[model samples]
Target chain A: MTGPWAEALPWVIALPLVGAALTPAVAVRRPRAAGFWAWGVLLVTAVLAAGLVSELLARGPFSYELGGWPAAYGIELRFDHFSAWVLPLALLFVVIVPFSWRYLDHVMPDERRPPFYALLLLNAGGMIGFCVTGDLFNLFVFTEVVSLSSYALVAVGGRGLAAFAALKYLFIGAVSSLLMLFATAQLFVLTGSLNMAEVSLRLAEVGGGTAVMVAFAAYAVSFMVKAAMFPVHVWLPDAHAIAPSPVSAVLSGMVVKVGIVGMLRVYQIYYGAEVLELGAFNLALVWLGAVSIVMGAFFAIFQDDIKLMLAYSTISNIGYIVLGLGLASPYAVIGASVHVFNHALIKATLFLAAGSIIHQTGFRTLSDLRGVARAMPQTSAAMAIGAVSIVGLPPTAGFVCKWYIALGAFEANQAPFGFALVFGALFIFIYYIRMLNAFYFQKPVHAAVAQASETPWSMRGPVVLLASLCLILGVLGGIPLTFVEPAVLDLLPLWGP
Target chain B: MLLFGLDLDYVAVVMLFCVGLYMLVAKSNLLKKLLGLNVMETAVFAFIVTAGMVEGGDPPIMVAGTSAPFASPIPHAMVLTGIVVAVSVTAVALALIVQIHAHFGTIEIDELKELP
Candidate 1:
């Protein structure tokens, strides 16, 4: 299956990284050029990603060995169905970079644009590497790249408060990353190999034991922190809310998925090895996921700051994906996987819309921004669409995935969890409904909000496009299923729990 | 030298990890907390380096002095990379701490929390 597209694998990861390094140099004469430079780099990367996905479809999975070194000895990059995620991931970056061009004018001085765009490119490249790498050590390294860039991005916007939040995020994030590194080393000591496929084979030979179980536990905790699930999610709200809007959209929409993807990778290895009993762990995930859904919504109801509310809602959406994954039924896993993509689209719509409102009126709380819909109809409309989609209402992107997950709860005979899903949705609906009411029904409290105009076309275009995607994906929900189904089915036979 | 049926080196690593975790959780000073994170990184790095040891093996170099039973070179490479990552993380953390101090005029978590 080695085709011309296969040859392009390493370049997909390389282009953004190299582009990031070159950003400051490229923008030394004109800082504004950094944004366009980033957009062009990401646009090329997206084309290559599309080519790789097409190759995957035509020839199944393919691998590229770095320096022509064989697998299990040297580094390898594999393009399987799961790696198809890079396509949507790159496309999201392409959309986001354009929005950030004008968006940064309000967030930072012109001189700062170069480093900001550089960090964004670093983040995108790191995530692309994280998705496609076939080595455990490389996974840890890429996780750091993503995590380090995110810490910088969170603090790149404002003063003291943003720094405080970014520092808090860094402390927790660093610890989780250490756990991941520890787990990788543990596996390496046990198997003498860092390649994921080879580790699975060697793990099967080693059989189930305390050491393997401990490593699995470490990986689980590490990724859960990354995903910002419930108790360990303390770092998320402040970091996501305080970041500049485009950074907020990126962090809230995509960065947290690092944890979920890491979890799927761990599952692939352990399930392939057929080692240890995962039943109790799965139950724990189910309960924690349910609690996260409720708790996230419960907190969101009280937040007056609109960005903070959106950040809390992210915890709730992540809960849905986690719950679906925990169910372990084919339908559930497929739903969970597709939700990873859909939630990103919907959240980007909401955050960019919210950012536009903040950019125009400089008001963040719902009460301060009443009647905003009257002044800025299109942005508010996009926000409304995003809100509906997030609440899992019909004919929106969020509906299809949540419905499949609900059906999966039934299929798995977990009727209680199925009910929990609905209850959580109702809780989510209440808060978004509050937002809509504030936008459309309430009278204005501030003149700035009442007279606010629509954002410039650069920002508004992405918001409108992403919001339309929320609805379009709803009608054509089957598309992502085509990519996720085969991958889930391949792992299902050994998915004991 | 064994402690509680485990190698003494392993026991030392566990103790170091716990000490670092305690500082991270119990201390209110941000710099101390960061130092604690560094301690934790060192403990993990020590564990990986120890894992690659061969009791009586030569260094993993390929010159005339090195021979069979060479210590695994992969873990060394991994730790080297890990150290580079740790340094970068520390650099970022310190930069953030500087910003926090500049803005809030304090590096203590408790004081930062009390401010409006």
Candidate 2:
């Protein structure tokens, strides 16, 4: 059973695709059952993902030819350690969607919910497929699946700004998708194969041609827009700030990271070390990253709205990953990969905790949040731990990422980037201190204690699970690093020691 | 007549692409913008189909009556999916714009920013 079924990598992606295909009918028949159906589908996908990982470990780098065609002509699904690990992380977030169902029901009225959870699960499946696949054109197809669902998810929550933010997302997504398609078209013209491995070999031969460079540029810039890199990062704060809390959780945690993975993959495979050995690409990314770090922090400082502030801080946090990628050392790549994994956990915890706060008190301003710690110590505690981690205190997941990233910058012979890491640490302190002051240290001007007990179990449970993961991943750091090191090693070149 | 056997779908596709992109960017009406996006997507679908076409190729579908040789179906497979996705995206974006109009009382991008 295991041997024959193990060959089926597409099942991991197909489960959600089929679920999305069936969603509208499910909602129309029994709207109440939609949440249950969504949960069941996502859980199946999660188990399938776990099973997929086990197979990959046993067999090593599983690839399945679509419709029984060979690699060159067929769309293939490949799951390496790198791609497989994102499975559980993505699955974990998908689990949070159903938990959000009851929570959202408490918030959003009945008229608002029919297709919502169905879309969420579909989007999750699409995100997982995007990460797991080896075909370049297939990757764009999965991207559109996720992107289209996201527009509706963002807009459906009934915030006036949510609609407009989704609109802005529409403009950007359309242009970026076109850019990616153009790049994909170029690759198709050049290699006549959609498979990544074959494309890599062909790309190496066609190395640094004008057409290839244009394709690389198009791919890079488009993915950067998705990753919300600075300058183009203008769309992020609004999208994050106004989107439903659960949706925000996914966007900040998983969606943006997928786009980063695309950039990193293409940079390594398509551009290679020789092109980067000349230092043009990394120079651009490093400067862009530094600017995002400083600028995102500065922007975060000024936001009065707490969600908006966190959104800006997310922009700053993503900067660390970009910086690590730009540094392009072994440790830097480790730092970047681990940072992606770590950011998902810590940021998910923070956003979910923030969601609980917004859900309970109906307040979005930091100043209005005095005495939240006493009022809701559970949530306050989670926020404190996540915030402290963001400031890069050791024995937390954030420390592992910052430690490697800062060291990676130094490894690249850039001491100033190391300093930039330290400065980033300091700014994290300043802001979280203010937030903590509002939450724990301040007097309760309104006596909001009785109203502020722990939130519903659904909200508290997911937030706790993620926050606990932050601590566990920090202490048991070597476990994930084992998986990540091999993956990152493949991406990087042998630098002069 | 035998000087050169060439087809000219590229010209039409390129022109349609330009016209669609211009309408999308320049139009103030949300519905029209959605139309533009659809037009652009169709134009792209045309290009993909053209790229896969051979001079005397059939529709690349199997039939019991005739196993006629046909153009590559790979691009067609991708384009079919693209068309469905394009429509899905258009539906979502149009829905968003409809809601935007309800709230801000205008479909114009310039006017909406004036809202507090």
Candidate 3:
């Protein structure tokens, strides 16, 4: 149980917060150094996350109590296959840091840039803490940290529209936070403890009651807003679309996924044992996921702004994650979990590459950016890989998850949802095809695209690395599937039994 | 009169929450919406604090030789944390409201929506 890696877990959250605290002073002296400083801290974080995963690989799931206190008495941070999301999250921040450097120069004023880096680091710290913590109150605290930083990050764009978007995002996000906090309070009232494992044990004794059901509903609805699920997703498109590109990438790629992580943790805590009959709720998830998929895809097809389209596509992809979990089968859960990893990879690549194109050409819409593929082959190729993977094409990581989820839908005897999953992909394919056609086949509609060239390596490197991982993960599907399978089995033992 | 043996405190919390949510949806003034949000958060915090209360309990602090029922300290601690979070949110929302006012010259949500 003891090893060198034992102490590294807390640092994964600490380094980013420490860096955030240090950023402004460094920024005052050398504003540009803030990005580099943030970059260096995040690299260490990525390494630590990878180290922890290797430790987990050797020795299953483990929990670390804060301040050397017992779990029931103090906060405990659990690291399971699910929370190992810190690895992907850290990798995302590492990619985003370099991408932000030159992109911010154009979009953010010099005086504002330092705070931007600080906020970015804070946001990353919050997300990493959110992923790793097992205490419900700790989760709420981290969620606020992430939400508040993100709201500011959006307004940092300083566009009139961006300011308005940030305000709307603030209200919606704050209300979601309130809902989740209330739910946490309800669980506290029922269980007399806030530790997730302890709460689960107590809930088993208290049994499902009207209050517990109300709490579950509150958690589900609030997380639905946070995850930007279809109906409650009004704030996401504008907020993501108007933010500077790297922020958009992080918001789309990582932040919304935190809601999914929270939702999964709730399931792990309350629904893990078959003592409570949750068939109705799982059925509700399947339908909600199905509708979001179709609805999100339909909305994406109409958006002309490249980032807006990507943002809408995110809602649809979140549907896939929820759908997989709803099926409640091992294959489905694995598919859903792996999709979390794959979607983050693909979406982040697409957003970064899109940002680079916008930075280079000053064009954001399809028609204006036509023939971009001919000018910037590498960026276009990365986008194409991401697009192809997102459409659930074979030989790509996206396909691996969708395949399992679709298979799980059938195995769960829910063929209509399986059809919805595939049909949703087809709907998504139409828009991606539209984008690809505009990128490759159409002639440049403006001088920007005609004169466009490849982005510098600082911006290019992260997108290319992520694009390549899409293929590598697809080909080496076992790498993630192995990490995913056991986690699913541990959470849902009755699956396929 | 007995109120169906229900916790009246919880009923009041729910009523406040619904009223706050209604203000958020029904009103369009940016400041009022922020107020509504505050009200909602206050309701949640109140609920947590009330949940920790014992019918005739003493304060949660321990004394040298006393043995009386005491309110749970955890929920009170959580309420303190929630209050800080609530204040931060309110400050940010007010700042954003000022920006919106300066830019649009109005804080009414309806009027703001009419801007280009």
Against the true structure, whose DockQ is highest?
1
Top-lDDT candidate index: 1
Question: How well is each residue in A1-497 modelled by candidate 2, as lDDT tens digits?
Answer: 24554665778778777887787777775676777777788878887787777776676666788889888877887777678655656566665775586668655765456578767877887888888788889889888888877877877786567898998888778767867876776677676777888887777666666767777888988888888888888888888888778888788878888678788667655544233332677778877887788888888888878778888887787888898888888887788788887887787788888988888877778877777788788888889889888778989989998899899999899889889878977886788888988888887655454367688887888888778878888898776687788777766654322
Worst 10 residues of 3 chain A by lDDT: A270-279
Worst 10 contiguous positions by lDDT, candidate 2 chain A: A269-278
Tell me the TM-score of model 2.
Answer: 0.91
Clashing residue pairs for model 3: none
Computed on alpha carbons, the lDDT of every model, listed in order, comes to 0.94, 0.78, 0.89
Cα deviation in Å at residue B93, candidate 1? 0.6
lDDT by residue (tens digit), candidate 3, A1-497: 75578678888899999889989998797788888999998999999999989888888778888999998989998888888889888988998899888888889777777899999999999999999998999999999999999998988877566778999999999999999999999999988889998898888888877888888888999899999988899999999988988999899989999889999888888765334677788888888888889999999999998999999999999999998988898778889999988898899989998999999999999979999999999999999999999999989889999999999988888898899899999999999999999999999988879889899889999889989999888888888787788878888864322
Q: What is the C-alpha RMSD of each candidate to the true structure, in Å?
A: 0.7, 3.5, 1.5
Q: Order the candidates by TM-score, highest first — what do you get?
A: 1, 3, 2
How well is each residue in B43-96 modelled by candidate 2, as lDDT tens digits? 777877766766677777777664566787777777888877787787778778
Can you list each candidate's DockQ?
A: 0.94, 0.48, 0.73
Please state the error at residue A148 of candidate 1 in Å. Answer: 0.5
